[model samples]
Target chain A: MEYETPLFFHVMRYAVRADRDVIDMVSGNPDWEPPEALREGLREYADLESSEFQYPPSDGLLELREEIAARRGVDRDQVVVTNGAGEANYLAMARALERDRGSEVLLTDPVYPYYPGKTTLLGGSQRFVAAGEDGQLDPERVREAASTDTSCLVVNTPNNPTGAVYPEETMRELVAVAEEYDAILLSDEVYDHYDLSGTFASALGVESENRIVTDSVSKTLAITGFRVGYAVFPHDLAEEAKSRHMLINVAGSRPAQYAVLDALRETDPAYHEANRELLAERVETFTGALEAAGAEYTRPDGAFYVMARFEGYPGTLENVEALIDDIGVAGMPGEAFGDSRSDWLRFALVTPRVEEAAERLAERFG
Target chain B: MEYETPLFFHVMRYAVRADRDVIDMVSGNPDWEPPEALREGLREYADLESSEFQYPPSDGLLELREEIAARRGVDRDQVVVTNGAGEANYLAMARALERDRGSEVLLTDPVYPYYPGKTTLLGGSQRFVAAGEDGQLDPERVREAASTDTSCLVVNTPNNPTGAVYPEETMRELVAVAEEYDAILLSDEVYDHYDLSGTFASALGVESENRIVTDSVSKTLAITGFRVGYAVFPHDLAEEAKSRHMLINVAGSRPAQYAVLDALRETDPAYHEANRELLAERVETFTGALEAAGAEYTRPDGAFYVMARFEGYPGTLENVEALIDDIGVAGMPGEAFGDSRSDWLRFALVTPRVEEAAERLAERFG
Candidate 1:
């Protein structure tokens, strides 16, 4: 019941410490400036009165929660500001299992690794339903995999590793599946702002008491280290989630939340659009190189990752290491995601060296 | 079972939103200036390069952990920088419970309410052992209350409600009891810096594999909102705790850690000494008023709280509310802690209004 693999940071650290020149495509930390107002907020916080440095409300700062609620079109009481989307998902999943409906958690194959790790940590059994090759999860497939014993079905849109944006109909059917099974639909939309398809739909859009949409300013504002994120829960679940959040971390960093609130209030939407365009360009460059290398790859619809499969190069720890040592480019081994994507490698196109890493992969694999 | 009482914030908020001129003695937030270097660190962080805003090492910033390790005399690997001592305690308790030895968690009565709340959240059954009237836990009492079925024993010192600082002999015997039961001892020493008594000892000094020390900069630096804390574990427990922390929170706030680390390195011991001296004065003033009022009370050995029992005025929610409404003062109801201290009210002396609050109580009750 332990995590089957070391976390992404392990591989990332190895790549980072390698003596050879390595272009990191392994980590998801965005290589872009955060909203200017975030830094401005930090500077301003330094001058605040001493009491301001004391604990914020255990749930979160009222203004930050209010902002998140307003932006997501949910009641302020429904939002539980978490340490990050990491804790948001954790709380959502924990609450789901706490309901006594079921202990079985439904996840996607080629999934975000943290989901399963969290399931094990929370003492829930995990069952993975494989998504299609295009990283698309068929609602029927999920429905078939779930049961009354399934406590929750977790999905990420504008997703990680595969970067598939679930469409409105798919989201609706998924919600229906959850409703039918009496399971919570825990939707992680941390990458919502990075949608390139212009069709990303939130589980929030599909109204249901069972839906919990978890998001963070980490990706949108390029401040993962800030650790300010929240979950929008059904009213029944919000109080418990906030209480759990309080017991877990007391609350997130107040200065971080303050900075994020300031940034949220002042930053223009154009800033997000500009970052999306930058990712779009990087995606094109990286995928074109995959094509030139004659490798099959998923052209991501959103987020900034591309999964590529090279012939005779089944993704494995050895191969991942060889790529790092020999070609000087680092990517996550597909096997790390789950068995379904075991033959592919996932590259995060978040670094400025995306084009350079693409060229290295093209030359080596071709 | 659910938490028996609402969290401290609920009461704090009630007092905050109260229309009366209540002198707040309920919340433990320190009313003092944090080291100036902390603010300087935040200002400097606002200008750091973009990559610095990405995730620090998931456990924590290496520099911060290293600083903590050096100061605490533990190996760097033994430290897992957490969201606060809150999460540090959570991970330590979780790891102890996960050992599969038992599910019963031993806690002190008149406990910090959050301890029992956390035990419940973690799905462990809780058993409370009452301390002496003076707020001192007799190790023999804890040994008598515990069994082989106990997974962990949690203690806070310089305690929250009672403010008892365990002497070395007590801590050593407590460690022995934990060893005998094959249970982990989770020590929350967030108030270590607030210790006014020269005799205050850390469980870390007791030296047992069963011991895990949880601490935070929140109380020490008077920056609870910074949310930077850590756990020091035996080597065997460190990796799993770090992994759990990563899943719970990708990492704590980098800027917060940076600021704390700066303050840790730059702030003089005299600053802490000054704060302690200030608290010592406040404690004397508050206790004199309690004596004048002819109320029974515990003179705290360390930390900044006083538990007082007024004649014909048992600590209850209604009584606490009446205090806020009629006497224009707020102190936490003793019933909120546990069964043993139900007749007493706990006042946090960490406020500038201690003199005013003391006068109000003396005039009304004397």
Candidate 2:
């Protein structure tokens, strides 16, 4: 196994230096604070005696699973809490691919990088289906890419980098394709709550036996450091996913799960709506600036990112590095997302200083 | 690509709830409270801003790694925090086997079940060296097991189930074998602090580059639920372990790491000593009761477990299940540990109800 370093995070580390006044528009970390209720839940649970800190039930705490199921409108048995959305994705892929030798995975071009990284590492090949010019995943392309060798299709709705939330029609079509091909659909909805368009489509309700939904509170509840995430599987795959999840990390942190339970139980819908509005404001301000700077870009429907192509600058790896070191503005090279055209860069909208980042980009490329 | 269910833990779960009033002496869980300082640290960290709850550094938080290094008496760069000792073991095995395709892992008979479980799952074969009647590992046996195919040796000091603390001289000899064979020594010292006879030994001080130590606060600090463990590896293997750790589960929980850090820094030595004394008392009482009931057992030098053999009863899977279902006392079947020809069952002595448990066993068997 030739292990590849997580280069995107590595770049983020380099860009977040103390001396550099860089405007970090890298990594999909939410800029807003977690809801007060959620934070208090964590605080309250943390203060409890250490006895409460023992190993969580291998499947997950019943309360947490029940809350997640209720929120997703699924059965509690369908959910398996994992280390994070990363582990959930890995488990879903492992469950789907391990059974079939020479299985290829279908991933949308410019998809979340981990889909390919994990697939390749797990002895599975990948087929990249290019997204359309509007920065939205094309169901027809995905259908065409499906073949006998493809065992899994990974779809990240409210997708990272492009923030293209799949509409219900698109999701239904994709789910239908997966059902037709008997391929497992691994849907990553980590950014589900960050949908600025408020039209988030869930793969869970897609009436397909092949769907596995991976999600986390990292983006929604802002508890990424807590490392609590989950997967909801069809009845057929739940046991295998549960077993693999136990093998992966035994269980995630106990206090984190308890906190998640409390948060889901107590958090107000107003908090989520307010956060979405804030992110929408940032996107507007930033995209307006990009237009002024004459950059070709697609405004995200959800998630906190924009895929912008600098007209004069063909965004190569060298250019990406130079922007971080020389220009002091950190963004992901689009090439990292997929083997698509490398002329685009991804700027994260989930930064506190979005206005300043826009100003910096304008200063350099206006 | 055929995946087997995790056998050891799966069996343990069955044995846990099989009987009413089952005295669980099977699993290696310590029945003690986490240090007050560690709990307080978690409380303090839980109240931190949501940004503090964002994704942790992939390798680990620097301060926690530094604390681990200082505790292990090694440089900070050598340590990488992991999900738990389980993940540490898995990561080390994966790294070792990944480096060499035909690599074989060596373990001792009556070993920690995870060694075999993880090795086999990671695409590596394992060879077991039998332990002496005294439950002590022989360095000569380890040397005999080493061959050109051997890639790593998994050793647990203050060994799990058996509780045989390997002497420094034996470790030195094993270290010599590791150096001569150019094989990595993956030492599990999760039970380091629970050494009853004050004879705990570590491979960290061994003058060998081919050594990795897997340990955690689960056993030492009595917070198994926290899932905070680490692997201290030679510089050559550090990067691989770190990368795998991140890919496997990103990192352990942030607040848990902070709690462990505080436990290491602020907790008094007396707190640890008190935990040790309590465990020691339980072991002594439990073993005495077993002996009076005509059960033959090895007195553990350290850790919270004792492997006992009943005179007439062979510790098969069926008998272990009967003990749980009929006698309401759960002890791990010796078969789960290894293929050794002994009627041995494991007893965890960390429970607060040790005296009552002993009396119950005495009444049943005496």
Candidate 3:
């Protein structure tokens, strides 16, 4: 398989060392304070006994997994803490493929590149079904695309690049399709807390053994550096995922998990509410600037990204670099995601300078 | 592949909540203080700016990589920091299989179970070459066992379950066999710091493009929960490994890496030397007790594990549990390693109560 490294880091690196100033809308690293509790937790961890510095339970610290399970309405046995949602997704996909129902992974076009990338890495064939223009996947289209050969279906809600939160009905229908095709529905809800529309539905709510949900506090808790995430599998599949996780990572960072657990317990709902409000405002400002530039764009309903199209400029790597060099604005080339969005540029509004980047884009493209 | 979960955790968990005071020789968790500098680093991290808590460079923190490169005598670009030595070894194995030389992996019998577990996880076939009774691999046997079908040779110096530090000449011959067979040589030298014998040889010392060495401070620093480790690849293989690392895990825990980097720079060699001395003392004491029990045991030349065969007691799941229940001591069943040593049991002498556990075993089995 070709090693198609994700381009987020590549573009971010280019923007970083560029001679001119570049507003980084390229990567998803959050530009906000993590929960105060998280820092406090880390400080507390430093004083932990020597044995506490050894490995946590291979699945995770039992307390954290129990907390995650309690919140997600699952048993603790169903949760396997992972390095991040990246590994969570990888484990979910591996479990799906390992079921031997099929070797083809069904993904959406204009997908999170890592989804297709991981499928290929795990030696599974990929089949893409394009999402609608507003970035919502149609269950009918997915059903049509899937067959007995479809081992898994990967969907990211409050999705990346194109932030569409699937409705509860869509999630149910997707689960039905997965059930009918004997395929696992792997839902990545890492952007769960970024649901500006409040219409986001979790696969965990779907009553199907065929569904697995992967999530992380990376975005929610604003602790991407902590590298803590988890997957909720059906009880039967949990053992294999845990085994895979143990073999792959042994365990997540105990300090990170401890911190995340403390944050989860101590941080108020207002913390999440405030971040959502902040992202909601950024979306309004950024999309309004796109309107000023007379560029076509999809204003995100969820997550912290906006996809825009300029009149004559296609979102190629060359165009992305040109914008970085010329306009001092950096965004991901949509073609890097998949062919469907080849003419669009996706910007992560994760920086405090989102408005400034929007102004830069409007002034130049306008 | 039947999800053969590594038995270490299963046995450890059994002992943890067992009805008695079981001495935990089952797991390799070191019972020692991590460097004071590491705790200081975590406290320092809690005070860093918010952006500093964001995702680190996918490969690793630059200073950490540079520090590792300088110490290991490899180019900075040749190193990829991983979740732990576990992920480092995973990445190396993935790269070797991706090279498509062959799908078969050559491993040592009486092996670290994770090596074969990883081989199966990666969809590769495994072939084992038995080690000598002293728990050391004969390079001639390795060369005789390897074929063009073998894509990689995974060896651990100061190895797990059996502490066999490869001599410089043995490492040279293993590299030669890998080079001759067009196989990648993946040497896991995680126990480099615990080399009780002065003759421990690193694959990095061999100038072969086929060589990849994986190491971590989990044992040396007694901070397994930090989950920071790295792999040094041949310059040509670095990119693919990095890409795989990124996809499998977006990044390692930034705080853990930051803290580890601090400890690496600030902690004196005395910390490591002191640890080695402690383990050497534990080995002498534990083995002496084993001798009193009239058991045939391999005295480790390096690493912390001791394998012993008790007369009339074949190492098996039931026997391991019986030993734990009756004698209140825990050790891994040798059959968990491979058929080559099914009659033996492996004990990790990493706890303060090693002497007590050793006494219990001697009294019961003698």
Candidate 4:
């Protein structure tokens, strides 16, 4: 259990202090607005009875859970609305430990930093498999890394930092490995709508008893601040998930969930299509900028991040600080993710200034 | 750790299945209207710039933190807004364990069940001290129970289930005991505004590094679903609290924060005074009915719960079920609180029909 502060927060801290001119290509906070219906939903919630404002059920609002269950093609009882995808992930891992499924939670290298932090918080051990050069998890690698002691495997599709989406084949193999070890598969698909390629496949599509798919309206609706998320677990695990959800944070935001519910009713494929168009364009611009900067990097298959090795410098904390100071552009160093690639940097194209961020990198380090 | 579901949820589940007319004195879901300003706040928040809907900072919105800090007479940096007091409590206990301050979290018997559940989730042990006959903590008893192995003491003032608000002298003595044991004192003041005795004293009223006061707008504003709460920590402990807060739930609800921020800005003592007046009326009516029923009970000093022992009936789970089934009134069993008071039943007078619930109990058992 390392006490390393995740790099995104560090960059945000710097960004908060940095001059207004500085470009914050750091944290994965979406800059886009949530769906208009979600905004309108707040107005509708405002007009409802005050009971709507009071403490919702510890599990969640039934209507919101119903909406999520319908969307995920699961029964309403299988869904537990959460504080965010963050809380959902925590519950999934905690359930694995509580049920004696395993003692350790496993993930791949270049993982989401908070996964490890959460595992430590629950007093569970963590192990990692190494992803291939493309930063996409190899099924064989995951199989090799897993053991009978592994309690859960956390998989992030349309992955953060590397922008690698797990395909259907990869997802099945991952599920198989998890089942073999009696491990739970925690699929964090918060970035599902950010996929630029057509090959993205959700673990939910595979339908395993061990799969717990966690997601939020953060990236899809661009309302991370609303702090609304949900997870779908096997029916047997629902009670534990609900209890853990309540103990962890009580319940998700009620008004926000209502807003999301309203948005859900009105959400069109065009809405997701439109958001992907924006993220997809930004990925191209960001990758182009990386190429111009003479940085060695893999083009992202999905999601909105690009990982580039800063050839001349170590991606140490000091180097990251220098990059933030010298170039007026902020990004997280690869060291923040794990010991997997201390030489690279993670650039998030969540900002509107994707092209300028790209140009700035080229001008500063090319 | 036992896999005991808290009595609130169990009772709530029963209430949900029982007749619609069944008086739900089970959970502390406040059944009053929030201040008009709080509702107006939602509309104002509804119209805010879209950035308000986007992810707020992991710590919290500065405006909300500033409001909380001002109310608590602390610097803004001392506050970390949370999902609710639930998450705040979790973070405080987790910080105690992580820092090696103590190995076990101590509380008075007839404790809030979630505290022990959270300790178990964090892989920490829980210990208990027997509370006074009135369900109020006695300093000598706490001192006797505490040991060097104690890491934290969770005190819910104007306490839950029992509704015994800790007075200033007792609070000071409790703080002294905690300081002696090098244990953090987590004061849950969510029910601070419900004081009927006018003897409410805050742990924050006596400043010390060991005192981390947690609260939420849930009980105070009757907006439990909004999921807005905060904890005031010593500046040294603030960092750990913030890290745990982020890892647990990332951030509090965004639009809910905005709505609460607006409410805080306009909240007058008159508002709380009005709420207390209503609760005071309910308490008198409910307690009178209890007396008529030949039930022995403690009149709450603060908060809206009453603990009563029905004549010649042991308040076990089966008895509680019979009470709900026969009387159409749902209340929690005292055994659900802790092992200390198996003969008593806990009743929440949060609903408007407090007199009806009280009357039904009298008719059934008197």
i-RMS, each model, one decimal: 1.4, 2.0, 1.0, 1.9
Tell me, by DockQ, which candidate is best.
3
Please give, for residues A1-366, the per-residue lDDT of candidate 3 as tens digits: 576788888788889988998888887888888989999999999999989998998899999999999999999999999998999999999999999999999999889999988998888999999999999999999999999999999999989979999999999999999999889999999999999998999988889999999999999999888899999999989988888888888888888998899999999999999999999999899999999999999989898899999999999999999999998999999999899999999999888888889889888899
Residue B298, model 4, lDDT: 78
Q: What is the overall TM-score of model 3 with all chains considered together?
A: 0.98
Task: Estimate, for each residue in B63-161, the C-alpha lDDT of model 2 and write its tens digit.
Answer: 988888887898888888888887887887777777673479998998776677677667788899998878799999899889978889888888877
- The DockQ of each candidate is 0.77, 0.61, 0.81, 0.67
In model 3, where do residues sit more than 4 Å from their true spots? Answer: none
Tens digits of per-residue lDDT, candidate 4, A1-366, equal 245457677777886787657788777777877788988999899888887787777778888888888888889898888888988898888888777866888877888899988888777888988887887898998888889889899989988878888889999998999899878999999988878878889898987898889999888888878878988989988887787777768777899888888998997889988888888788788778778878888688777788888678877777777787787778888888878878888887788888988898888778
Which residue runs of candidate 1 sit more than 4 Å off their true CA positions?
A: A4-6
Q: Estimate, for each residue in B1-366, the C-alpha lDDT of model 4 and write its tens digit.
A: 345456677777876787657888887888888877887888888888776677688888998898888888999999998988888888888887777866888877889888888888677788888888886788898888889888999899988878888899989988898899888988989999898988999998887888899999998888888888888989988987787787878888888888888888888889889889998898899999989988899798888788999867877888888888788888888888888888988888888888889888889878
- Tens-place lDDT per residue, model 2, A1-366, is 655555677678778763567877777777688877665776787667655777778778888998889989999999999888888888899888875733999988877777777876778888989987766888899998898787899989898767788899888888888888788888899989888887889987788898889999888887778888999999888887776676657778887788778888888989889888898898899989999998888798998888888877866667877887776889888877766647888888777788888887887888
Q: Is candidate 1 or candidate 2 better by TM-score?
A: 1
Scored by CA lDDT, what does every candidate get?
Answer: 0.90, 0.80, 0.91, 0.84
Candidate 1 lDDT tens digits, A1-366: 265434588789889889899988887889999999999999999999999999898888999999999999999999988989999999999999999899999999889999998998888999999899888999999999989899999999988888999999999999999999889999999999999999999999988999999999999999989999999999998887877888888888999999999999999999999999999999889989989999999999998799999999998978999999998999999999999999999999888888899999999988
- Per-model chain B TM-scores are 0.98, 0.95, 0.99, 0.97
Which is the winner by TM-score between candidate 2 and candidate 3?
Answer: 3
What DockQ class does candidate 4 belong to? medium
**What is the C-alpha lDDT profile of model 3 across B1-105, one tens digit per residue?**
475678888788788878998888887788989999999999999999988888899999999999999999989999999999999999999899989999999
True contacts kept of each: 0.81, 0.58, 0.82, 0.80
